[model samples]
Target chain A: MLTPPETEPLTPEDRTLMGPGPSEVHPRVLRVMSAPLVGHLDDSFIEIMNEVQDLLRYVFQTENQWAIPVSGTGSAAMEAAFANVVEPGDTVLVPTNGYFGGRMASMAERAGGEVAYVDAPWGEPLKPAVVEDAFHQHDPDIFGFVHAETSTGALQPNVPELTDIAHEHGAYVIADSVTSLGGVEFRVDEWDIDVAYSGAQKCLSCPPGASPLTLNDRTMEKVLNRDTEVRSWYLDLSLLEGYWGDDRSYHHTAPITNIYALREALQLVAEEGLEARWERHEAMATQLKQGLEALGLELNPEDEYWLPSLNAVRIPDGIDESALLSDMQADHNLEVASGLGDLEGEIIRIGCMGYSARTSNIELVLYALEDALRNQGYEP
Target chain B: MLTPPETEPLTPEDRTLMGPGPSEVHPRVLRVMSAPLVGHLDDSFIEIMNEVQDLLRYVFQTENQWAIPVSGTGSAAMEAAFANVVEPGDTVLVPTNGYFGGRMASMAERAGGEVAYVDAPWGEPLKPAVVEDAFHQHDPDIFGFVHAETSTGALQPNVPELTDIAHEHGAYVIADSVTSLGGVEFRVDEWDIDVAYSGAQKCLSCPPGASPLTLNDRTMEKVLNRDTEVRSWYLDLSLLEGYWGDDRSYHHTAPITNIYALREALQLVAEEGLEARWERHEAMATQLKQGLEALGLELNPEDEYWLPSLNAVRIPDGIDESALLSDMQADHNLEVASGLGDLEGEIIRIGCMGYSARTSNIELVLYALEDALRNQGYEP
Candidate 1:
């Protein structure tokens, strides 16, 4: 038998989260997560479920009847979209522009779909012309691209153009909006996106458990008419439909506390309104970006496609990235992330998302970063 | 655009959770859920991860080095086990004993395994002779059985015998210990369970995310040596090894608050020794059973197979199950479950698990159930 250690009370560092995702959670969401849980099949919880779905649709900018939170984190929602829509032998087109697009390819291949590539270098968004060329060449049944690349901090523009290309090719389009769901400008219907998935801990400012997923009628139709069963039973949408749809039955137990937190978080979104919230993120990120540029740091992506939620700044010469991070963390209870995937060691990711997107946080981040840089013998 | 409802503060009905799972969360765990956030890749969180793994191993009663929590609820962990171990064309043997067995078959088939069944009626434990017979007949590659059948409230006895049979057939064994892990007696290593997975909500009395999963070296070998990739990218344990294993790198953003809740819950388990905790469940369940008998209801399973965590009591003749549940919910705010699958309309599942496994809660359940039955015009 294993002996249990004398564990202390759970008192996390209370750090200011400025990472790629999992921005600091809203106080209301945190409080709601502590609320006692009703049974998953209870009438009250069913009501909560309906409200959560409605709130999810509001933020996703879609009238898709299938808008709901997948009961895991962001990657689970990502897998659910691919695993359901892509059947065996389906040719799936995925972007190579960011870290998440590579993840999309991995999920598609695991779902038994043949993955075809739409080429773009890392840290660059897929151009509509390139997407069109790829569609003409591969004729994929499904096309997936990242709307906001968390790894590269580049937001894909010309959404309607990309969607039109897929529609003309008789392919479904899936948008990976993990970094920009609530705090950025996105329209599912106007942009003609058939499916989109997001994480709660991103722009929503909720904890990372239940993730947001929406599927329009066209996309769900393809899922429902799949030639074979979805390979992941835990993520099967048809089974989840019984629970989230009008049936309101038990498919599996949801993360009830996470759902409560999400409902509260989305309610905050409704109160603030999506447009105003997006502006807030942009305004804060602009302040941080100007400070970085003044401190001799260059933003990685072009200004037109700069992601307001996650600011990626290239490391200056003679700056020690690891030491700077350690000093900032040790001196100020703050967190900033290093670059992931192809961009690793080249840039630092500073998130201005959700409740973390505020003038005070931006100023504090700039000060701490400058102080850390000075300590590392770099003039700021 | 979807119009947001006039949402009030999240005020879910304060419920006495006694359903199949998601029992009343410990107050300490609930408090921790409201605590501040930490990045999943933070050094602080990495230390907490080690502690959580240790605590998990303690409750699971295993020396297996691969013990960690799957990032969703119970079913995600279940799928992770099967999706990794059961490769395509493998003949897997599963029991037809309860709802979960059917679920296991579905998951195995989705994992590309051909499923064969070992026969047993609902609410009954599998007999060794029958298991041996099935193994000899089928010559299966993998065998799965529920350690405690939640749907039917039957505790599977002779665990060693079952594992021995699987081993003799050169098959690995996977046990579903969702409802039994913390509250009841489960010896993972001593019983030779090659793999086992459980939910935090049931016996742990934590919220339903970050479920417990452990695999012995033999099981991990099969998984690591598999020819094909696991179907679900979110649940692939080999990739998970980078985060939870030695590297402690980022695999996915974990549900940090849920992990905090689980650590507190597991600490409580350690405070009350496992044997003492198992006896507490047995004692509380026995009291509930007597009260149920006094109310002229019989438990569905026999004493030897009675599950201490979830008790399946026979619905008295002419007792309206729906009315009984509604009245109990409305009047007492107590949550009990209606029977599922094969035992539907015949039994009501009353849970005495985790924090809800106490004399007061058990007595309250008896009183409320009796009052509901009386209101339904049933008498002793």
Candidate 2:
């Protein structure tokens, strides 16, 4: 028999979360995580599910009845959307501008769809002209793009135009709303995107399980009429509908505690009206951006496509990016992430989201970052 | 814009969870779920991951260093095991004895495997001879069986014999150890289980989200060398290795709270000692069984095959099963489950698992069940 670990009780370092996602969880949401769990199919949990759906609909800004929480993380919700909607032999057009777009391409290919890219450089949003040209060139069946690219800190500016291009080409549009859903302006119905998926941790300030997912009736119809079985049984939405839909039958154990935490988190979002919440994110991010500018730091994305929830601040020359991150973590107990993918070592991502999108957090981040940079012998 | 839900704070019913799964979670685990947030890739979290892996190995009774928790619930881990190991055109042999066996078939088929089954009636273990015959006939690449059938409250006997047969046939063995992992006696290495998957909510008394999965190197080799990609990107073990392995990169956001809860729960398992914990479940179940017998109730599974964690008791003639279930919930604030799948309406599933396996809970269940029976006019 193997010896058991002398593991202590979980007391993780309480860092101020300002990274790409997992922004600070609201106290109410944290409290609910410790709440007693009922059975997954318990009558009470089914009621909780209904309430979460309603709250999710509110957050997603759509009355789509298909709005529900996927049991895993954001990627699971994303894969659920792609695997269900993109049938084998279908042509799927995905963006090549950020980390999530590449992830989308991988998921679509795994679903047996031929992946084609609508290209835009990293740290920039897809232009409608390029998107339309690609749609005409590829004749794709499904088009996926990130509404807010966390990796690049770029929010796609003209969502309706991109959706219009897809609709003109007779394609279903799927939006990766992982970073934009609650903290920024997005309207599922008005935007005319057929499907959208987001994570709880990013803008919701909930923990990272039980991600938000929604599909319009048109997309749900396509999923229902799929010529091929959805590749993943765990992500099969047709069977999932039996649980999250009217039947409320068991699909899998619905991550009960995460759902509870999400309900509380989304309830917070609702209390702060969605638009008000978005403005809160923008205002705090502006404060952070002004502070960074005072330190002579350049923001990576252009203002038109700047994502208020995640700030991509470019590292100045001779500024030790790794040292800046470590000093902040060591001295300030704060979290600001280094760049991802092609932009690695060139930028740091700082987030303003949900409960974390506050003037106090913004001030702390600005103070710590400037202090760390000064320690690295950088002065404007 | 949709109106926000005027939902009150989550005050779910304070319940003593005694269901087929989701046994009463330990207090330590519950407390950890409310712990502060950390980035999924935080250094502290990586250390926690290592401790969880070590604890999982001890609980699973294996030296397999590949043990890790799959994000999502138990079914996700089960799907991960099959989708990775059972490649296209593979002949997968599954059992037809209970609910999960059918689920295994569904997953295997979705993994592009042709499913063949060794038949046994519900609530019965697969005979070694039948399994051998099926392996010979099908020449299957993988053989999966449920070690503890939660639906029927029956634990498979002679596990070594079953695994030995698969080993002789050169087939990898996957065991559904969901119900038996901690509360019942199971040794993954000793029993020669090549791959085993379990849920956190069952015998571990942890909330469901991150689930236990382990693969011996032999199984890992097969998964790594697969001809086709795993169907579910979220459950793909190879890519998952990049995150959970030495690389410490990101694959997906793990359920942070769930991992914390699981770590706390597994630590409790280690402190209690695995064999002693199994004995506690067996003893509590014995007490419950004697009480049911006194109430003129009969258990569905035979004594030798009884699963201590989930006790399936037969419904008496002329008794309303729904009334029996509803009355207990309505009166006692207690939760017990009705039968599922083949055993539906034939039995009531009573759980004596992890934190729920105390003498006090046994007394409460016996008293409540007896009272519910009397209210239904089924007096002894």
Looking at chain B only, the TM-scores across the models are 0.98, 0.99
Q: lDDT of each structure?
A: 0.91, 0.92
**lDDT tens digits, residue span A68-155, model 1:** 9999999999999999999999999999988888899999999999999999999999998999899889999999999999999999
The A-chain TM-scores of all the candidates are 0.99, 0.99
Q: What is the DockQ of the complex in model 2?
A: 0.85
Q: Which runs of model 2 end up more than 4 angstroms from their true locations? A: none
True contacts kept of 2: 0.85
- Model 1, which residues run further than 4 Å from truth? none
lDDT of 2 by residue, B209-257 (tens): 9999999999999999988889888999999999988998989999888
Clashes of each: 0, 0
Chain B structural similarity as TM-score, candidate 1:
0.98
Model 2: docking quality category:
high
